[model samples]
Target: MSVPALEARGLVKQFGALLATDDVSFTIQAGARQALIGPNGAGKTTLINLLTGVVEPTEGQVLLQDHNVTALSSSQRVRLGLSRTFQINQLFPHLTPAESLGLAISERNGSGADFWRVAGTRPAIVAEIEELLTRFGLEGEMDQPTRKLPYGKQRLLEIALALATRPRVLLLDEPAAGVPEEERQDILAALSALPADVAILLIEHDMDLVFTFATRISVLVAGRLLTEGEPEEIAADERVRAVYLGEDAG
Candidate 1:
């Protein structure tokens, strides 16, 4: 059997007396689309941080493809094929989307500091960057500065940048948070179309998109994993319905 694409075993993180993540444990199989859902302040982002090495866990381990990664730094984790996008947009405000993606791809290829070398001068790299932007539906706006793009477009660009790293596992923290209702579908579509080789661990509040995209769902509450299973099973679970799904009838 193949090892899971990502695993968090007995993970724990605390800020003073606050237990941000309490003994969290879960595994995301290769090629799986998994949703990590919880109400606000449920430690979902903290867990993402732990997995990506943004905030070191107070205790427990994070494994990427069965390799211990708990001790790795964020950049080291990215180099190891683990990548993520933030809840807030992170982009080069003045650079065009094309330029931003090109830089990202170049960095992933270890040529980031070659400022003297123009990305457009490299046909292969330029072509690849254009393809990524087009794939994520940002082709027509490629030449526009990131700050000029709509909020939804900026979010999409962030995902595209993470993809440029060619990650084995993608961690998305609230991909749809600030997106308008009309544009949310585009975000969902792009996320659903990620390559099968890439396992996704998504932290999202949009239940419609979450239910539609997640093959497996994990529920967290009070910094602990409450339950996890297939969407239907989760929906039918009495405990889940009573606590998390009370607003929607089972």
Candidate 2:
């Protein structure tokens, strides 16, 4: 059998007496578009933290391409093809999109310390930055400082930075949270253009984008895996509607 792109097995997290994640287990098949959805305080963020090595699990393991990465640090995991974006934007406020993405690509290449030489002297890296900016619809804003860009564009640029790492499994935490409706299509389009082999585990509350983008959906409730199925099955599930998605979710 082929190994999954990412997996969480019997994961648990606790803070004093609060159980943030409870025995959460799931798999993201290679190249799958999977959505994780639940009401607020459902432990979605905790789970993502555990998966990305931002926090250690009280119990269980995180696997990347069949290798155990439970003990790895976030940077080590990124080197192993695991990368994620945050609920809030994590971009260099002072840097332009091109400069930021160049830094990311350079870091992943283990040559970030040599930026002065690499940024201008490396044709390949320059080409890659241009490609990423164009791919994420940031070509027009490439020279503007990230703080100067609109919220939607900043969100897109953050995702672009994640992509610059060339991850095999990408965990996106609310990529559309603060983006306005008019600009959401830009985010969606960029996401749709991701390479087919890059598995995306999306944590989002926007039902429209969720339903339209994910082939499969996993519903969490109070830090536990409530149910998982195809988008249609999840949409029709009464339990899901009552606990999370509204009755009119479909």
Candidate 3:
């Protein structure tokens, strides 16, 4: 079998007396469209942090393409083809989308200080930036300062910026959060069209988005791997229905 794009092995995260993640284990195969869903404060954030190396795990390991990355910092992981977008937009308000993409792409090439210079020296990079902007529906917003764009556009920019890193695995945390109803479909379309080679793990609360985008689903409840399966299986699970689907368990 091909190696998984990302894997978690018996992960556990504890804070004082609270067990945030409890012995969870799972894998995201290359080219997979996976969703991680759960209730509020269900340790989803903690698990994402552990996977991305934002926090050290109290126990267990994270492997990227079967290589141990449990000891690496988040930035180090990003350098190794791991990238993530936030639940809230993380963007530079002053930079245009094109400039932001240039900066991220330049940073990927170790030219973090010279985004414009990189674009000047490399037409290929400029083309790439333009293409990504178009793909994420930000082409029209490209030249405008990020802060001036609508919230949905800002969310798209954040995802575009993550893609700018050329990641093999992408973690998306609530990509549609705070987006207006009218713009939500655009976000859904953009997400549905992501590069197939880049495995994605979506951490989201939007059931419509989750069911629409995921081929596989992993349910996290109180920091544990309650279950993982195809979307249909997950939707039909009695336990999942009880805890998540708002259906009567009986």
Each model's TM-score? 0.96, 0.96, 0.95
* C-alpha lDDT of all candidate models, in order: 0.91, 0.92, 0.91
lDDT string for model 1 (1-250, tens) is: 7899999999999999999999999999998899999877989988898999999999999999999999999999998889999999988999998988887788788887786876668888888987898889999899998899999999999999999989999999889988998999899889988898899988998888889999999999989999999999988888878777775554
User: How many clashes show up per model?
Assistant: 0, 0, 0
Residue-wise C-alpha lDDT for candidate 3, range 1-250, written one tens digit per residue: 9999999999999999999999999999998999999988889888988999999999999999999999999999999999999997889999899999988888798877763553636887888898998899888988998999989899999899999999999999999999999999989989988998999999998898999999999999988889999999998898898898873233
lDDT of 2 at 197: 95
Give Cα distance to truth, residue 45, candidate 2, Å: 0.6
Query: Which runs of model 1 end up more than 4 angstroms from their true locations?
Result: 247-250
User: Could you tell me which residue pairs clash in candidate 1?
Assistant: none
Give the TM-score (vs. native) of candidate 1: 0.96
User: Candidate 2: where are CA atoms >4 Å away?
Assistant: 115-118, 247-250
lDDT of 2 by residue, 1-250 (tens): 6899999999999989999999999999999999999999999999999999999999999999999999999999999999999999988999889899988898898887883574746888899998988888889999998999999999988799999999999999999998988999998998888899999999998989999999999999999999999999998898998888773554
